[model samples]
Target: FRKVVHIEQGGLVKPERDDTEFQHPCFLRGQEQLLENIKRKVTSVSTLKSEDIKIRQDSVTKLLTDVQLMKGKQECMDSKLLAMKHSFSS
Candidate 1:
């Protein structure tokens, strides 16, 4: 008989609070790292392995881009939510 891999979400986490000050990179670098030794999509997978230590320009660039864009994203979200609230109540 073959084995089946079953996966299900715990659903205990609040998606909005994940990036709070307490956890830093939400779930500490990633829940994937703790559960499966997986790293961020654009970072070094394993520091223990020399082959995985190489740095690519795009990797760091994407991180910086994300940080810089966060404020703008929040602003857009805020405006969209306000508009929706007004329309919803109208």
Candidate 2:
């Protein structure tokens, strides 16, 4: 009689195979290590992407503030030029 293997998934246990060859210790360890490595890589990439987006947002906000400051300076300069012109014309 062959050994039976029951695979549990999603709260359900189902018989998968009748062979014992799939229960190798080295193979299981390698699979576990591969899954862990994949998880780490995914987490690293996700964090990098999130930080990149935040950096871009901060750059955009700084640029907007710089533009507003330039506009204010331009308005002040225009008012000063107009006052000078009026005094010179008089």
Best by TM-score: 2
Local distance difference test, per candidate?
A: 0.58, 0.65
Q: Ten consecutive residues with minimal summed lDDT in candidate 1? A: 1-10
Estimate, for each residue in 1-90, the C-alpha lDDT of model 1 and write its tens digit. Answer: 122222332345445433322222334443655644433455445644654344565678888999889988999999999999999999
Candidate achieving the largest lDDT: 2
> What lDDT does model 1 reach?
0.58
lDDT of 2 at 15: 36
Candidate 2 lDDT over 1-90, as tens digits, reads 223344443224543543343333333454766443332113555567787889999999999999999999999999999999999999
Return the TM-score for candidate 2, rounded to 2 decimals: 0.47
TM-score attained by model 1: 0.29
List residue ranges in candidate 2 displaced over 4 A.
1-48
